[model samples]
Target: MADTWTAIDFETANQDRGSACAVGLVRVVDGRPVERHSTLIRPPDPVRHFSHHNVAVHGITAADVAHAPAWDAVWRRILDFADGGALVAHNAPFDMGVVRRACAHTGLGHPAIDYACTLALSRRTWRALADHRLPTVCAHIGHRVTRHHRADADAEAAARIMIAAMSEHGTTSLAELSRAAGLRLGRLDAVTAPTPVAAPSPVGPAADRFDHWRRAAETPMPQACPDADPSGPLFGRTVCLSGDLAAMDKPEAWRRVAEAGGHPARNVTRTTDVLVVGSHAGVGKTAKHRRAETYRERGQRIDIITEAELLSRLGMTGA
Candidate 1:
């Protein structure tokens, strides 16, 4: 078990994993972060357009990195920062995909570096949790994550999460922890390695019924709201909704958004200015949610709030 590794996170400009716009790297030695690096890079042309949803997620914009280096120019620095140590990330596949695809797209050779996922580790470490999302796992382990989408902050959080897991399992090295969890640490170099997928746990009929209900609750239907206030607080804003709204149906919700002078959008895109995520929104992995998250990662000013919060902004108490 090596005590040193580099934990990394990448924020993409769009759905293409190779379209990385920003990266955060944290170097941990002896289970402590000793160095860190973060930077923004322009995605390749022809696919360089950043989606509104992704911009809302990370807050990065084309203008911000207009003069910044592109991936080809930036990859060397990332390699130097890793210094040949193993790499780690919350979701290793996404980040590694960015690295691999970016290299492939740019005609650059992939660097041979081993990587591990704290996400997979978290599942084994905190099996009782309802889900193993980064924020959820971070909160479960009492790690402070001030910024969720920023590559730097996310990388640091991932490092802390892994370190905490190591401590809990009495494993001094990532290799040992991977062995204990019956998981494999991923690698990238001569050949791409597949990320280990955790096997599904068996659930009884009652569990199946609950899951059905849960899935239904997550897939909210879009509603059309009319007679919006053109001069309202949400005026000029493009709003999208996800998850189940207990207070109102989709039509009523859309109506309220329109009434508030906002454009109600059925899909999340680069143009969306706000996303109202309702409770039980099983949309953490949805394409729409991911797009919104990408926008948030770039430091774009997209308001992502709960349904109640959106209603409060619209000066309403309920449907």
Candidate 2:
């Protein structure tokens, strides 16, 4: 946890994690941030179903990227900016997933990233804060941030918060502060840029099946948040994930949910807190999760995240 690194934020098209359409980078060296970069990346998939909610956030649209470079085109720049540094973000695994998808698409070697999450660091450093959300945290620290969902502004704000935290905590060097922030690089590759993954035939049974589901229904809200307050939707509860978070690593992201006074349960049952669905989720488990259905039908509290949207939710936007 003792290294200077770059922080990144990705905004995706709609709700797909694999659909990173824009990225931002902030490089911090010697505890002072330098080198901010951002670019719109065209996902291989067209950004259909663009949401008003999302458009309000990042301001990206099909029109904006009518002729932009694909994710394949701009990934090298992202990798280069991240060179020789641990990748820092609010949610480490989410950004890593987007990076993984970009790698998978290009057939490139997945780059190793040392990680430091402001999300995790917030819990460690700011025990008095009400919420660790970017804007909330920034407001608590008295930093004026305008855009709530853009990638660059958020990344810069995160970088500033990191700098302030280090100063407040009195960590003289990047290494010292990094360790305190839980910066960890496990078996990370030393290379700056990786060879791209070869193109997959964007056509296949899995792709077709997944597409069919998207084309069929209005793409149902995946699953509900899955926690019900006697009064409202998980207003003041805790939800946890154990075993596996499936894809996008639920435990890592949901750590914030738990820290926020939402209790996360290790086991699923009648008394279980919430069920976070992962890629490894099974229909049998769904069948067993009758609680989810019951709550959904009654308009209680429920939440589910697809692997990709989970990653997207974790993506930090300056917007």
Candidate 3:
């Protein structure tokens, strides 16, 4: 609760974090909303396409933002409106990620700001609630968000939620509210576009060791479990594995697939029906992953999913 702060919400055109198609902001002064601002943005070239899922969520189509200002232009206005004040958002990480990633793509300097998450605050203050989603929290505190996905309405709702949380905790400032709720105010440090770096080639013994490790990581195909549940999601599906799964190794993953009545293959062949890709951030796609995509492009009905999705389908999420 610095005398002034901005509450923000961003709608992305696609899954990419930098694809900010619209933004809503509400500025609060002395615990009261003083200004409301919103704009539709044309996402940068690299991630400008609107996905059907995203459109369904926010109801903002490509036609809606065809003539809108680009991210850099809107970002400047956002900074001007904030006037160096802290930011508050329902989920600060997502909105702030949009800021950082969009800035990186455009080579614009990232904003250095302190921020608070009304969502986190609500979770801590109203721990008894079944869920701490924005709409749920707002409804709990009697703040009606008539337009759920609209940027302006969401920003306003977040602002009001923060105000209510402050009152609930009997705290006059952000610091006080954070301490009372046993949470910490998050910060966004100043950042700029990163320089590309080429990976160094391993030499001599290191290269040999790397090759050995790579070969050792590739697990042999497991035989399908004859007694596995036939009604399972993976039943009768030919599943392939790729990348490093968080919970288990490749052998465990293949075994689980077999346990679910799936035929686990060592590679993505013509018969492969599903490719379970694991978490491999900041790395190039694995050979199996690329093969699956190629087959899909050629009209193969291949399902590409993540490790979490695989576990969920197998009814072993926490396993």
Each model's RMSD to truth, in Å?
17.4, 9.4, 14.5
Q: Compared with the true structure, what per-residue lDDT tens digits does model 3 show for residues 31-132?
A: 889999999999877767776657777899889999999988999999999999889987576688678778776778865798887766776688787556
Q: Top model by lDDT, which number?
A: 3
Task: State TM-scores per candidate.
Answer: 0.60, 0.63, 0.63
Per-residue lDDT for 171-289 in model 2, tens only? 85545765765543323444445554333222222345444334323322122222211122233543434323322223334443432335545444445445555533344545425
- Candidate 2 lDDT: 0.57
Worst 10 residues of 3 by lDDT: 196-205
- For model 1, residues 77-186, the per-residue Cα lDDT tens digits are 88888888888987575588678777766667765788887766776678787555677778898987788889999999899998998899888888888888767677
Q: Specify the poorest-scoring 10-residue window by lDDT in model 2.
A: 221-230
lDDT of each: 0.72, 0.57, 0.76
Task: Output candidate 1 Cα RMSD.
Answer: 17.4
Better model by lDDT: candidate 1 vs candidate 3: 3
Full ranking by TM-score: 3, 2, 1
Give the Å shift of residue 171 in candidate 2: 1.4
